[model samples]
Target: MHLADILALRPVPAAALLMAITRRCPLTCAHCSTSSLLSSEEHPAEWFSGFVETIEPEDRPELIMLTGGEPMLRPRLVSSIASAARSLGTRTMVLTGGFFAPRVPPALDDVAHVSVSLDVFHQREVPRENVFRLVHVLAERGVAVSFHVVGSGPDDPYLTEVIETIRREFRDGVPILVGRVRAAGRARAWATADERVSSDRPRPCTMAAWPTVSADGTIAACCNQDVLDHRPIPGHLRLGHVSSDSWRSIRTRCRTSPLLRAIRTGGPQWASGRSDGGYCGTCRLLGTEQEAPASPAIAYLEQQVIHAQLSAGPAGFMRRYGEARFADLVMLGR
Candidate 1:
């Protein structure tokens, strides 16, 4: 979505502009969310630069997220992205596999924060020693560090190792945000078994600030727009082009409409909440640990999901949704 058209959707001061610089990824994690992999197209650096220029001084945001299968793979990318972000008086953050962290230009370190993906897949593609090196470099440069655990994949034999590693990191105060794999394209077809989940919990609360603009630039009331409405962010959507519309009020009503339903479970004994414990039944069962020795049930589910995907061609689903309209991280509103 065009940046101007996106801002017209709602006044979101804290926006997470998810710029998928490149979809090419070296690691094929078992549970890959967003499924942005090799062969993905990158928006032109000029396009992004123009976007940064379009942000009025008054429209500065708290954070702008640069993500993708691996954003660092863009050969031409250096401080160009960081410079565009810094020019707007906003803090820039990046999500990377850390394989190319060492190659990051020295100037990009200032005013940029990084969230490293450190799952078993990351370990395989990027040496642990290398990840530590990247982390140290970024830390020395004063960039904030956070790690995301990609656990929703078929139970890797290394489940114990992954959990153990993340636990230690969490204990040390390095923030650990558990990422729910969203079912898009191939992930969505077998979502039941694969459980491409997210942190967004259906709430009775109002989404006053959250809004998302799709790649085509149409605006939606929240981040779940693609999942629910299947509408392009800046273009085709349930609420077409909110150019002159008061997006604040429109989004408010849309968020609370009784006839409308989001990805929510009803009543008790149903799945709900942001964390695992908050949900009941199937949702809780997704990752619940038993007192007895771990069985292969969960593992089987993961395999079954993959097997079904393989048989049906998982690539089809992966190709369905290219990228998120916005990258607020949490809540469609930033």
Candidate 2:
């Protein structure tokens, strides 16, 4: 669907929804957000279905983004989501780690896109051969595919080769985005902050341009910025929880937010704090707002944090995607 259509809606209905079907993932990357440590929480299929029922009928986003610890871990989810959107003539999409790439999406034609996260450890976790095998399947099924790459670290010498390979191979016409690791949960628990994390370079987050819905059922201004950027672990209202009041306040505020207004008005200097400088500022702000930095242990963990800049060919591309030699991305689940 056209993003312009969503932009034209009254109250500008959330352009899309982002939901994390499951927080459980197989691959343990270093800078994972969500601080995703709670693996024992079993997400039921019905929970997903109920979440679906919560999206406001008027704002049924044309695109639905399913993410997770690794969304593919939840079997039959992609299919179910597509079916729901198709029932409303909308399209569904997913951000997978290529766990089930070769699998067929049940509701064949309703999927709009499938973004596969291809990082260095991808092969180790999901197996490399399986990823390529799945990508081929997604292509045949007509699901538009994009690559989400996590860059190689300064501590890891193998990263340069991996990035060059991606630039040469998968980056042609296919959308490419870069990202950095935030030592939220497991990453914070184990990984040490890398030198690359301290650059003041700027990056753009396009995810904000689209509407996002969280798994628990709340419509959000953007997915990546949800709880991570919000002050209070972000209330679940946007996830379809205590609707009306929360989002009523948030949505209204977003429309007038200087940042949002700037982007909408084509202000040359748009900022969601997507810079090492801004991220740092925002992080400090988060700490102050939550009284979170007091714990010496967490402070030490933040000290171990690494922030760096990446190359984004597209103007709004995120740069945490380190330069690496990974060209072949295997899509494991659809």
Candidate 3:
């Protein structure tokens, strides 16, 4: 699958699954989101394999995105999940730090897409040329490739230089998804807070649409790092555990939860009817706030919002969720 194809489905509820297969990474980039270390916590392989095995061909997500502190560390698990997901008609994608570059992993054979991380922090551990080489090989093998690049911000000189180089080296064959580093994970200690003005407007939250499987196998309604790492996940955002919940069950909850539906259609500020917290802060506070009851109005609004987002396409989705300055880059290899 192409990068645009995967991102185009990003707004649809339960259309995709983001699974953090492991939290152990060899490269300790300074801005590492998961704060992964060689001894970082990673669950037993069965926790992941067992959950994937439960996916029935008739009721499965269109895509399964495998990620981690470094998902490539578990080559066998990556191959196993890709094979199983593909057999069920579900495309699989992997996001890696490219530590094993210069030698592509045999497991990626079953993967339809691979997105490698490229940035200043990552370059400290994994060479940019090695990542480029890995993408080159993957592209030659007919596997779709893209770059998940991060920089200080849209105007950061590093982003400009690297983007230009990537466009030149790949001749725009490899799409790039550029984003600003957030104050999360290991970067929390030093990364500056986002300065975007918080608004009480009814802004829809697309992040709440997909179910994210955290490192410990706890499934969350959103991909927020705090939700993934914190204990006692807010009642509203916590989905059933992978150890017990099947894909169908999780999808049902994600799609049917009244609060989640409202969040998707009108955002947390609108759903909770309070704007004390920021966008995500308001979402995290939903557990304490009342849950929006299922209603025809909410259902209708959800569909309308989904339709509008679908009309916006991949670059549009990036414009809202990613850095707008470079949103068109997602269309480079389309």
Candidate 4:
């Protein structure tokens, strides 16, 4: 699948699954989101394989996104999971820090897309030259590829220079997803706090549309790093464990939960009528009050909201979730 195809499904519930297959990474980037290390905890390959085996062709997601401290670290496991998902008509995507450069892993040969993480922090560990070489190799091999770049903000000089460099190197033949550095994982110590949402306005969370499988095999309603890292996930955001929950069960809860619907359509501020602790903090505090079954009118309104977002298309979604300045770059190579 291409980058535009993936972003176009951002607002649809359960359109895809984000699986963090491992937490062990070779490099120690300062902004590592999962706080991955050489010795980070990783469950047996069976845990991931068994869960993927449950994906039926009729009930599978459109895509399966594999991530980790470094997903490429476990090439065999990545290939197995991708093969299983592909067998059920689900395409696979892998996001990595690109520790193995100038040598694409054989396991990724069948992956639909590969996104490499590139930033000033990552350059200290993996040279820019190596990352470029790897991307060229993948593109030459007929695999769709892109870059996931993080910067201080839209005006960061490094962000500008790097985008220019990539466009020059690839002649705008590759796409990029640019985002602001978030205060999660190791970056929490230094990354700036996210801009607070105005309590007076609604800010629907698009991230909640897809289910994310944490490194430990617990699935969450959204990809919030904090929620995934904490033990005993907040009652509202917790989906279920991969070890015990089937894809059908997780997708059903994600799609049918009234509270999750509220979060996606109207945001936590709308659900509670008052922001308790920022946007996501108040989300964690929402309870049965927001779990009322959706009336016919409410359900219709929810559908309208989803359709509206979908109509805006991928670039529009990027403008809302990613850096607005470079949002159009997501569709560059499409």
Candidate 5:
């Protein structure tokens, strides 16, 4: 599966599952999204594989994305999940820090796609050369590969330089998904806050569409780092935990929850009827408010919004959620 193929399904509800297999990472990059270290909490391997096992062949997501503070750390778990997902007709993708760069993990054989983290912050810990080498080997093996690049902003010189270099080195064989640094994890203290969504008009939040399995087995409605870190996840955003809930139940709640449906169609600002807090901030507050009553109109609106989003394609998704300047880069190797 190509990166664009995976991204195209991003807006669809329950189209994919994101599992953070482990939180422990060897590289302590300054901008680490999970602030992962060797000591960071990692749950039992069964908590992850058991969930994948629950995904019945007839009712499974189109894709299963494995992520972590570093997913490569648990090679065996990656292989297990990928093999099971594949058997159920679900494609699998892995996003890694490339700490094991220049050496392709054997687990990668079971996956369909691989995205390596390559950015200024990551380069401080993981050499870009080693990451490039790893990706090259994976590409040669017929496993689709892409780079998840991050920078300070669209105008960041680092983005310009690295993007050009990747294109040059790979001869445009590898696609790049460029995004700006967010105020999360280690970067929270310094990284500027992302622009807030205004309540004036409806702004659909695509992030709420997928279910994210966190390190401790808790499954959240969205992939926001804060939502994943909270001890008692907000009622509305909380899907059932992996330890107790089956994939069918989690996906059903994700699609049927009125609040999530509203958020996916009109965003947290409209769903919670407040935008004083930023996008995610307002989403967090929804737990304190009454759940949005379900209605046929809301359901209709969600389908309409998803249709419009599907029309926009992957590059369009990048323009809205990622840096617009490099949005088209996602289509580089398509």
Candidate 6:
């Protein structure tokens, strides 16, 4: 699958799954999201394999995205999961830091797509030339590839230079997903916080649609770095542990949860009606608050909202959650 195809499915509930296969990475970029290192914690391959085995063909996610400090660190496990997911009609994608650039691992042979993280910070560790070489190899091998670039903001000169470079180098054959660096993970200490949602309007969270599996085996409702890293995940956001929970169980909770539905359709501020804090802060508080039962009217309205977003398509999603200037790049080489 291509980047456009993946982003188009972003607003659909339970359409995809994200697995953080390992926390160990060779690179030590200053703005690392997971605060990963060569000695970071990592779970056994069996835990991940067992979870994939439970994905029944009839009720499985459309895609399974493998990520990590660097998922390529465990090539065999990546291949195994991709093979398993493909058997059930589910495609797989892997996002890596490209530490092993210029050398495509056999593990990624079965993956539908591969996303490489490239930015000023990442370049400090993995040379830009090496990443370009790797991307060329993957594309030559027929593996759909893209770059996940982050910058200080829309006007960052680094973003401008790198984007132009990628376009020139690939001749627009490769696409990119551009985003602003958020105040999360290692960047939390220095990066500026993202803009907060207005209390006056609903700002739905598109990221909540995909269930994320953390390194510790806990499955969270969303991919918030804090939610994944912190202990005692809020009850409302905690789906279940992969060690015990089945795919059916997780999907049911993701699709049926009233809080999640409210957040997805109306955003955390809209759902909670308290704008004293940030967007995710309000979301974290949702578990403690008492939520009324969803009425038929509310359900109908939410469905309408979902349909509208679905019709708006991937570019719309990128306009909201990604760097708007580069949103159309997602459809490049489609």
Comparing 1 with 4 on TM-score, the higher-scoring candidate is 4
The per-model lDDT (C-alpha) reads 0.44, 0.47, 0.90, 0.89, 0.92, 0.90
Model 4 error, position 329 (Å)? 0.4
For model 5, how does the per-residue alpha-carbon lDDT over 21-64 read when each residue is reduced to its tens digit? Answer: 99999998999879999999999999899989999987899999
- The residue-by-residue lDDT of candidate 3 on 206-311, one tens digit each, is 9999999999999999998978889989999999888999998999999999999999998888888877788788888887868788899898999999999999
Residue pair clashes in candidate 4: none
Candidate 4, superposed: residue stretches over 4 Å from native: 288-290
Error of 3 at 174 (Å): 0.7
Candidate 4 local lDDT, 47-125, one digit each (tens):
8888888888888999999999899989999999888988899999999999998688898798999999999999998
Per-residue lDDT over 208-280 for candidate 6, one digit per residue giving the tens place of the 0 to 100 score: 8889999989999999998898989998899998899998999999988888888888888888887776788
Worst 10 residues of 1 by lDDT: 325-334
- On lDDT, the leading prediction is 5
> Lowest summed-lDDT stretch of 10 residues in model 2?
305-314
TM-score of 2: 0.60
Which of 3 and 6 is the better model by lDDT?
Answer: 3
User: What value does the lDDT take at residue 1 in candidate 3?
Assistant: 90
State the weakest 10-residue window (summed lDDT) of model 6.
290-299
Better of 2 and 5 by lDDT: 5
lDDT (Cα, 0-100) at 125 in candidate 6: 83
TM-score of 3: 0.98
Error of 3 at 93 (Å): 0.2
Q: Cα lDDT of model 4 overall?
A: 0.89
Ranking by lDDT: 5, 3, 6, 4, 2, 1
lDDT of 2 by residue, 1-334 (tens): 2212221231232445566766677666555665443363445667666556555556465566677767666657667777777787667767777655556545434567766777665656666556656655766666676666665344454345554554455444344444445444555565544433433333223333444544443454455433433544443212233233343344444444434333232211222323343433443233223321124443232222211111112221222223332322222121
Error of 1 at 24 (Å): 3.0
